[model samples]
Target chain A: MSRVCVPRDAATLAVGADAVAGAIAERGVEVVRTGSRGLVWLEPMIEVETVAGRIAYGPVMAKDLPGLFEADFLNGGEHLLRLGRPEDHPWLAGQTRITFARCGILDPASLDDYRAHGGFKGLERAREIGPAATIAAVTDSGLRGRGGAGFPAGIKWRTVAEAPGETKYIVCNADEGDSGTFADRMIMEGDPFTLLEGMAIAAFAVGASKGYVYSRSEYPHANATFGAAIETARSAGVLSDFDVELRVGAGAYVCGEETALLESLEGKRGQVRAKPPLPAHQGLFGKPTVVNNVLTLATTPWVLAKGGEAYAALGVGRSRGTQPIQLAGNVRYPGVYEAPFGLTLGEIVNDIGGGTASGRPVKAVQCGGPLGAYFPPSLFDTVYDYEAFAARDGLIGHGGVVVFDDTVDMAAQARFAFQFCALESCGKCTPCRIGSVRGAETMQRVMDGVDTEANLALITDLCETLKFGSLCALGGFTPYPVMSAINHWPEDFHVVRDI
Target chain B: MTSLEPWRPERGEEIIAGLTRLDGAVLPMFHALQGAFGHVPKETVAMIAHALNLSRAEVFGALSFYHDFRHEPPGARLVKICRAESCQAMGGEAASRFLLADLGIDWGETTPDGAVTVEPVYCLGLCAVSPAALVDGQPLGRVDGMLLVEAARA
Candidate 1:
């Protein structure tokens, strides 16, 4: 049997798959492309055969090829470093790779690689059933926008499709601003075609002739990967008929918001726009548009191709299908994990994530992105679904779980949330812009032991106002962290008051 | 090759000539001037303004709007520590403190020796590894006090 080894870097693997195949020649090993083990820290991680098992050494840069052969990596012998079967690793085994099915598995840019691993099978199948069938499939799958909003993907598409407009646009919100969330980045970097295919499906469903992928400037690798993928798709006639453009965002947090993103794409300041005319009604230079998160679009191909019921089979409650949960911060195994939404936060943090890296008990787990609420260890039993999190006054904001240990100060974290809002506020609304700055100051006063009770009360009131009065989520959700910290860890706010 | 003369009349004539060869020359002309000099040099802006028949303020406004366009020269190294929520959640405060102490400069401050300039970036998309920082635009994840010092030193 001839074995073919592809490097973990999807770009290099895409270009080098042919060369590796050519070198193998008549050696005659069946080529099996498997999903990446999610050990990105040891990237370009390649495994070859030996008498014992598959040996792995990594962070294999491009120039290390010659020395690798001399080291007898084909035999799976012990070298300076060698990991046994990659699949056996607890980290890899624990993960449920749904959205990231193609990551580390196929050569990212290769249409052939994508097709081999059931890539466009979804699109091909989608085309057969037509638009209504595609919508039904997605709705059945119960997929939600993975970009932190958690909005139902099927419902959003149906709205855009049903909206009245001569020129409709399909816009992909690739501005991944949340901390601990790299599923979007990984998908783009490891499998750009999936995203493109997903976007194409959205365009077709919404009757949009043009599409745009608004990627953040922070992710240079993602930008390059998507850019190249778009070109490849165009040349291959996948996107030949659609007018698609990749617009790089000029580093703005507020731009992650759907309306704010549209404003930035128009080459204007990244400010949040007042809703009501929501992009569905009038968007992108005054036209009906469908603005979807990267994860939302990426999940589309699967729903369309596999049929809606098949996609919906996973997950529990309002949250359906698989979620690409990001484990970050003090977690021992900080990486991307995909799992059905039924898993408990405790199970994800302790069982899968291996608890805090500091060997301390997890004090709190911040689910979702920056704006997501912090759940105290008491609420560790909280299930990983939208309604479950909402019940506890928390949100599954983009499925990013940042674990914090005992050393963490909740008051400081609360202050940070306010400070972050102050810095990133689009300044279009009063509550978010001014309230954030005032909230930060109040948090500081509480921390400084000045009228601590009053300060705490003021901060909570401020959060309530921001939540109710803001124009967009940037302001609306700023209260999540502040309130969560105050509610969960009351002692952090306790301070000595003097006359 | 085009003439390197800095005179308004000569530069204006050259810009007009360059515009004739290209369909959309306004952006390209601005880019060319910025590319030639480290910053959009005053002389180059004047030349473009004169050539395009636009005021210098109009050119300056456009340049200032873009974060990439810098009027002043940059330091040797650009250290952008993520002050966003994800990084903050990951002991970013301690990391920031360590960096400031080590480098003797706060966020947005360049070192006296011009070795490094520490800036606060909202996010670098390395949220999975919180307390992440980018050195000269290369993202470094799971950054701590030691890593921050090592990166600064390196």
Candidate 2:
């Protein structure tokens, strides 16, 4: 009996993965529902277990099943949509998928399937070597927080482990509110067991007995899938020492911030609190806690399975590991691509991305989320490293690259940056709340062709205030998009000036 | 899944009682109420405050801060369109214009017949397949105005 597979992830389902699965179920072949490969364009991608490996076909619709059956796709026969061996595809072949190794290729909810693909090996290894060794492996790997801040992950675990407390908590920040980023969602939806296992390992490493996954309400699919994965982990005895609760964040972008997330987890308004009592020292319900991003926690299993030095040997400089770059917008090959840190913006956006879907010359690339800076083609040479992006006044935040074609209005984009800040700011600080509104008005005056030069100066000055004075990155980094627009695309800001 | 029918008073009391022992139970209580009753009703607010020992004013203050907790029930079907940066780069504004013109409604307005309520969401994490929208929480990607209208109908 041939085993056929179709994606059950949210994106694939949105594109009718379930319909394809339903179409295949009637065929009476042993159909296995699997996770997505993140080759989103080829989603509803069907695979059959062939003598050679898994043979692939794709973006398959319910109506196409009859033709596929006739084509002998079960035997890897030729078909219009046959993608040959999926891993061998040029778009996916170059990826160094240590963290996402089993993502699209395995049954997300099946423990047997997960174990077959090297799932719990990291946890087993962590158990053998003990907590200190696990932390050492992560530290030696130079793993930083993939959740924007780039702080050392091992240091965070060490603090929680060493903190004096009767009870400590491990919190996974799954509040992935940043636009143009879907890596966290992909992992949660595709290979949820990995996150489950990773959280369990973090609990063991830090000597914490309880854990909480704070995911936003926007991702209902993720909530359902991850909720199931937790039950599987519990039954499998993988969570013997660790207990986890899944908390949903109501629609609040500021909740993505660590402190605000903590507040929301405790059933309060997602508000930013003062520091000095860092989460590791005093966190959820005023207890010692270790807070880490979904990606950061998900990556830990791989860091343990493969030695820290082995993981560390991949990327250039301080980056030290492969970053999962999610390509979006005008890019032709918009999917998840993981590579070592030294790859330039051009290599990822142009070579890997295959330029804009419209076939127009690429005008700009937003290297992070809404708050990330906009870059022109001239800066395409910049490397994908924390320090490198920061040097260019950008941050390799969560590795979300949103491409823009030549038709974009940079001035309008700048206004949106300020407008977004004003809308999402936690209002705990004055500079963020007032400066964003003032900045939007300043951009409008420029568009209105009134005092254009001084208005430009005012926008720049306002950006400086928001950058330094704001309480959190929500307000602090609004300047990245605004300043970069003025610096690189002054021609757009020159809108109808003195006409 | 915002519903129009009023939630049971007894069910709301059970929700508050079930979560009363948790460290900070207001938000969870709100989520429970919203889950049971399409939106948090004014009567339930006082019920939750009384059950959880929080002042009614304190409960209202917390409820309004976050955008997810709605005060009123929505139409039968909900339509959410992404107006985020990724969608914008892919002619998202043009698509939005088409839907707005065709439906005779703006971003947050509901149709007069109460068939659908249209709203703008920042991002659906479907940026890889740009120009996305969600109808009743099921996503539609690489969507145009026709696809969006169809999604709403679906």
Candidate 3:
């Protein structure tokens, strides 16, 4: 029987991967459901095992099955949809996939497949070298938090390791609520064992035996897939010593923050907490905890498998190792592209992304999440490093790059930045809570051309207050988008200026 | 999955009792109650509070904070449209306006016959294929107003 592969990833399923898989399976062809390759534009992307290698075809729907069978696609024959070999594809070939190495290549639920793909090697190495060496390796690797903050991961692990506590916790912040970002969701759904192995390594390093993955409720598919992977790992004794639990988040974007996530895990409102007693010291039932982003944890195995120095040589500046940049929105070719941290924003949005899908000139690209800044084409020269983005008042937040065409209205987008903050704010601090609503109202007034100059000044003052006074990034960084719009495109605000 | 059992006190108590053993049972209990019944009925506050040995105010506060929990039962079918930036860039606003106008209902409102309820969500992580939506948990990507309406009706 010829072996055929189809993605069971949610993004592919949303576009009819299931139907295509069923269609092929009904024809007596052996079908293996795998995770996405992150080439979402070519999703429902199917591959066939030939003597040569795996041949690819994509964006396939159920209706295309009959014609595909006639064309002998099962044996990698001629077809219009054929993308040839996936690895040779420029998108896949250009990536330096350390964390996502096994993603979309193996069955997520099969322990045998995971191990065959070089999984759990990190945990084994960590065990061999001992906890102190493991921390030293991570610290030497120069891996930082991929989750917006860009904090040093090794420093956090060491803090929890040294903190005086009989019981410590390892919490994976998988609450991926960012709009243009899906790298975390993809990892959880694609290579779950990697995350488990990373968490286990962290547990060994910090004396924590319990782990929790806090994911959003919006991702039912990812949750189910990851849940099964956890069970498979547990039953196979991979997680025998370190117990792991999956906690579903209840539709709170604020919970993506580490401290707020801890509070929510303890069954409280997803509210932000004050700093100083950082999560490393007091978190998740007031115990010392090592809270890291999914990507940060998932990449640990790679840093361990290869020596830390080897990993550190890959990227530029403080950002070491490959960053999985998610190209989304109006981009022509949108997907997850992992590369070293030196790629310029222009190279990412223009060359890799193929510009806007609308066939129009690209106006602005929002880097990071909703909290990230909107960079016009003029600022595309800035590099993708964390500090580089910070210098430009931008954030490589979760590595999401959402593009926009020339038709975009900056004033409305500016207003939306404030509105989003207003809606998702934890209401723990007055600056974020009140500032956001006032900012939105003021931006609307400016757009309405009612005392435009005064309202613009007010928005500027409010953003400053939000930046300094807000407790978490939700408020502090909300000004990135709001102010970037006003500074880059002042004409947008004066569209209906009082005549 | 569309039809749900009517809210019953004994059933609610059983669900609450079963989940109280977990460290943070409130959120899970809310999910279970909503799964069994269409929504987290208003009466579930006191029942969960009593079972978990917490004040009803705390339970209610937790319940109200998250956007997932619903106070009242929804229409037979639910349609969630993405209001986030990625979707917005792909003409989601126009699609959403068409959906709302065609259905004669605004955001977070249900039709008169209670056939379908519409709500706005931040993002569904399907940004590559923008203008995405979820109809009762089935994600649809590269969708338009008509596609959403058809999925809801189906």
Candidate 4:
């Protein structure tokens, strides 16, 4: 009679969560492998549906289960590990969760569980109103691409829908290579049906019979979860009109770029292609294709279910809808924090994140993954809006907020950014290919105090070239960190001269 | 450190044939080969090329371009450490340093004892519990020098 929820998320599983789930199930409770609630700090977070409410016991290790059982956990019993009523928890109670509303709340692969919790409502609505209306609804919703570009989603969909081709394609860019981002992975692993439904809806809207979810191999669990979900959807005949297949990338960061993703999809190296024969015009084997980030596609079902105006009602400016901002790194409370687009960086780092686990003052925060510009404590008031970030030489890239404490060396961090660029560059363009190596070496000189002023200037000059000269974001955005480090934390660079 | 299973030509051909029908079948075929055998065997280039009507160089070009595909054999265990900003902010660099020192091998090198091979991965999305590392593809979160060393040793 007891329904137990255990997160099968990768972070949870890494800490022996699977074994813990197995142990709990053997204790005579009906176990449900649900998606993570994004409360990563309290992972393998177990919830038992009891008479009182869903009593939670989190971060439960296999070793902790015996004590939980002894405490009579099944009956909502008292225990040190107990966190009663997940909703009442301050973390869950505070913010808007429209995008991730169903995440960690339902059994990921269960179509029935998904349906019970407002699943397929968007697709049903889309089907009822037809593709043209569905596209119009999305257009009205004001949902821009969550994949860093901030292009309108409905506009992109309409392009593929209207493009001249009987064979159109819906490609989900689940290759989330950005360091601080995990929203795409979480959606695929936790509520895969939503992503599947979104893709199916997209295929229907575009008149495409085929779809592909190009997930990164880094997320083995996500890839597996999505693969199983596809099979489940396939069996249930949910994919009658449109078919979806999962494709995986082999550790290529550039593959996250839409065009590069298309290249990799064609079974080739992930190299950035020239833009203007946009993927919409000629994509995926010379067919019109609609490439969207997982977050964008996943958000579609909701926009359809609720009218676009209703969805667009929230947030500020041109940036519409909510962002599933991931609070990562040194923060005390690290997890996915979903909120509207206008919250300040200060609010996210201090309030939601609860500051660094190191107890040091937050020195800086890097939003939108590594490609995003670093914000000093002074710029904490900066808003999370796409245009706002762009105005400040930053980006709300995929809503990943990586917080750093005073102990962090900005110079070293800058060097690593270029080094990462050097390591991951697709080797197609010269500026990124050559500039990154030089930038990294220059950063080291700045670090070593070798002609500090001159080296710093050289690093600054080199970054500009990489910023404008590189072929893709990998090279183009590496300068963000380097420049931000120099601009905001010049003291750190100056201190190296004393060293 | 888990090395790919020794390539069986028949099995490689079987994987290639099964996947060659899909659009952009080459990538899928390479992924399947790596999934079946931890690394795609060099022999797969010609087999996959012939099946997909691609040149061996084209196949090899793809195999070498992506960082995930390993060429030589790995060790008994694989330790992929997260060196991304999130991890670094949470002492990931220190954990990696400890792991490297403890194992007496640099990044991307196998231990002399062949106990483990270390590779620096960008991120594993365990940023919430920062300083994450993957020991044999199993993630370890909230890692420290001691934990990373223990992971490498294990």
Candidate 5:
């Protein structure tokens, strides 16, 4: 008999999975394991193969299981929850799936389930190739850090691996403090073993004996999931050589930065440190550290498992590999969708996201997190890539695209960008600390129509100073939203000038 | 005065005593004290200083550096509204205004009844839903003004 796989989406696994298992078992069919498809709303998405295709059903609750079973639903009988083909669904069809390749395809906590669906193949491959060869594979893949800052991942590993030190560390920045971004949280919670396998590979590559996952305290579920995953990995011998521990952060936005994350991990206040000596040299208690975002490290094992060229061939221009793009807010289909770098903002916002849920015209889409720039409807055609976004005064910040309808106020948004920086500023430098508060005040003046022209000029100058003088992006890129809002939606600013 | 009287037994004394025995315990002691009593009380700070043989100023500076440490007590319900970009992109401003208007208080201010204290949080990692907010540290996503009020009331 053909084995069928049914996912436990949002509801309790035993209630949902057991019912499906019991129903299928009664038919003398075997049941298999798989992870969630990340479309949380359409949960308990059941998949069964027939001569026609892989039939799928979703939003299936425990109460509906008996009816589904009575109809022999395992063999793809017509039901209210029936979705003909899993791959044919527009939501799943458009995704590229690099970091989240195994999600919804394997049982999250099961190592055996993972291995069956291409888990640890990267680690096993890394073990054969050795550290140097492994690093070369990543370098060839052209994989940049997916943690907002698009730094080369291989070069970072090389620095830590080559660093002449006995005590090295691998720190995963699971402190995803950016709004409109839950890729890290989803990866950790849904498919934690992949991240564990990836981190273990990094530990081996960097010759690091210890690894730490600095997860945000805001994601209690993610923290619990990661904590449990670490324990499971340790007992399963996957993390036998390297010790992995999870440190819960007390919900600080600045902790998302690599330097600030290290400070937080050290049990100090989450504040950004000056970088002359990068974390590669002085990090995590003054040891050579391989600090990478969750997505960056999660992609490592895959790079080793598949050839670097295979992964490199996926994206356009300087950007390579697939990004776990989160399609969130004011959209009909708000969920995680993976795609290559070449897709345009219009395609993502309209095509994939199915436009705004409000049925109003799409006004603007904010690419990246809080520090990212907001693109007006005019620039909707702009391609979604690192270099393209940077050219347009934006960054593909952690692949977060927040859609906004015409109801959004550009002036308020501009003011909020400054306010956010002021609140999150680590106060390591004056430009960020003093400049942000000044920027907020100046933006407020512009909004209030008090000396509007002078206030705009002052805000522009302040942004420049903060960009040039600040130590990190928290201060540096705070102006992206401010300038973009002013440039695109000039009418929003209370300027006295007549056309 | 009666409420303040219970604090005379060195409010966080048990926690302070437990943390004091560890090696390099100064930092851990302060953390434990803060964990026990939302913020490090003056008496607890003094006791920690005496136990760790560190100055009161040293303990105070440590307390001041961390954002989690607060000088005043939090309300029975702590509502943290996400001010991050995604939340902002999804009508967070309107939500904030509605909350302020409905509650008759601005962000970081407590209601007159001492029932709820609303503060602005950068992000709660519920970006997909957008316009997210948290009440008493429990995350609620895709929130509106009515939702915030309902959460506050609940």
Candidate 6:
């Protein structure tokens, strides 16, 4: 029987990959369920082992099974759904493929598969070079946190290493609550061993004996897959003396914040704690902790294996290394496009994304998540680097690019930014808690043509308060979307004014 | 999803006992209790507090802080629709409206017959597929109101 590969990634599974896999297996074929290739639109894409390498057919439903079998697709016969070799596809070919190098290609649960794909090389290298050198390598790599903060990963590790604590912890913030982002989830479900290896290296470097991956409850598939990978790594003794546990977070967006995540891990309410002691100095049960995002930790393995300078060679300016930019929403080719920084927004939203899925003119794109700014097509020339985007009041937060066609309502979207903050505010700070609700009401009055200009002014002032007064990014960043909407698409806000 | 058993103090205690020794066991205990009983029954708050050596106020505060831990039993199946920006760009609001209107109920409300309860979830990381939903914890993407209705009914 020929071996066929199918994605078990949550998005593909949601669209019926299981049924397609079952149908293929019913033909007495060996079906291997792997993670998604990040070519999301062609999900349930099956690859067959052929003399010319793996040939692909995709977006396949269960009903296509009989035809596929009849076409003798086991040997990569020509079919309507055939897309030739997957790597040759423009989408996959254009990507840099650093952190996500082995994602869709390997079976996440198999430590052997991971090893064969250059997995634990980083950990081995870290061990060989010793702890200080390992930390130095990451420091020299110029790698910053991919969790939107853009903080240096090596500095955090060094702080934890130097901090005074008998017991320290490594925490992986896998709580990917961003609306258009799924890179962390993809990595966890597709290449879990990489994350574990990275964590192991971090634990070794920081002198931490325990590590915890704080994941969200919404990611049931990722939690299950990563949990199994943890068991496999433990059994294989790859974790060595370091112990890692997967902790699930209840549905609290605020918990995605580092301090709140530590609070949630401590079995307390998911409330944000003030900074001064920083997580690296005192965190996670009042011990020095290294809290890093999933992407930040996962990228460590590559940084270690390839040498820090090699990893640093790519990406423009300070945003070194590749980012798994998630192209989503109304885009035609919605998938993770792993590339170096400096690609213009226009190129990403147009060339790589293939424009709007609805065949309409693209009006706006929201980078980052709910707290991100909305960029009109006018600012499409902005570069993808963190500092570059920040220069334009935009951010490459988590590298999520959500496209929207002309049919979208920026006024409504602005309102949602407030409403979402109101619904999810941790209630620790008064500005985010009270200001968000007030902002939502004012936006509603504007939408209803009641004192539109005055309400708009009030919103601008309130956004200022929410931006600077809030304790954390939750309230602090909410104004980005609100003000961006008012600035870029002012017509949407003025549509119902004083009629 | 399997049918949830009626809330039992013994079963709750047993679940709590298995995880009480874990560091920060409250959330896991809450999850287990919800798994068995469909929701964290009010009675188990005191039991969890006692077992974990925390105050009832602290336990309730923790429980109430999270949206996942419900205080009441849901319908036979739980249906969560995406209401976040990515989904909205693809007409999630319209689909959500269609489903809610069809069911003659509002968000977070159960159908009259207790067949399904619809809730608003921000995102399920299915933004690429758009208009996604979770029926009894199983994800479905590229959905419309009709599709969600059919899936929830199924």
The TM-score obtained by model 3 is 0.99
Query: How do the residues B64-117 of candidate 5 rate in per-residue lDDT, one tens digit apiece?
Result: 665555566666777888777667667877888898899899878889998878
Q: Could you report the DockQ of all the candidates, in the order they appear?
A: 0.30, 0.73, 0.84, 0.80, 0.32, 0.85
Instruction: Evaluate model 6 with DockQ and give the value.
Output: 0.85
TM-scores for all predictions: 0.85, 0.97, 0.99, 0.97, 0.86, 0.99
| Alpha-carbon shift of residue A58 in model 1 (angstroms) | 5.5
lDDT per residue (tens digit) for residues A1-499 in model 3:
5798898888998999989999999988899888899999999899999987899998799999898899998789899999999999999998998988988889888889988999888998998999999999999999999898989999999999999989999999999888899999999888899999999999999999999999988888999999998898888899759999999988899999999999999988999999979989998899999999999999999899897898899889898888999999999999899999999999999999999999999999999989999999999899999999999988999999999999999999999999999999999999999999999999989988899998999999999999999999999999999999999999999997453
Candidate 4 chain A worst ten-residue window by lDDT = A490-499
Estimate, for each residue in A111-175, the C-alpha lDDT of model 4 and write its tens digit. Answer: 99999999999999999999999999999999999898889989998999889968899999998
What is candidate 2's CA lDDT for residue B62? 77
C-alpha local distance difference test of each model: 0.74, 0.87, 0.92, 0.88, 0.78, 0.92
Worst 10 residues of 3 chain B by lDDT: B1-10
- Where does model 2 exceed 4 Å of error? A497-499, B1-5
**Fnat per candidate:** 0.37, 0.70, 0.73, 0.80, 0.41, 0.75
Model 3 in CAPRI terms: which quality? Answer: high
Candidate 3, clashing residue pairs?
Answer: none
lDDT over C-alpha atoms for residue A339 of model 3: 95
- Candidate 2 colliding pairs: none
lDDT of 2 by residue, B63-100 (tens): 98787787777777888788889999998878887887
- Residue-level lDDT of model 2, residues A159-191, one tens digit each, is 989999889999999988878899999899889
Please tell me which predicted candidate would have the highest DockQ against the true structure: 6
By summed lDDT, the worst window of 10 consecutive residues in model 2 chain A runs over A490-499
Q: Give candidate 1 regions above 4 Å deviation.
A: A1-36, A40-44, A49-71, A78-81, A495-499, B1-71, B144-150
Candidate 4 Cα deviation (angstroms), residue A163: 1.1
**What is candidate 5's CAPRI-style docking category based on DockQ?**
acceptable
Tens-place lDDT per residue, model 5, A1-499, is 4457775322214124556656666667776645557664465567776667678787666677778777667678889888888778878877878788877766676777777878888888988999999888998999999998999999999998999889999999998877778889878867888898889888888899898888875676677667887888888888769988787665568888999888777655567888868899888889999998899889887888888999999989989988988877677667788877898888888888889878898887888988889888789878889999999999898888888888887888888888888877888899999999999998888877888888899999999999999988899998898899899988889655232
- Each prediction's RMSD over C-alphas, in Å, is 5.8, 1.7, 1.2, 1.6, 5.0, 1.1
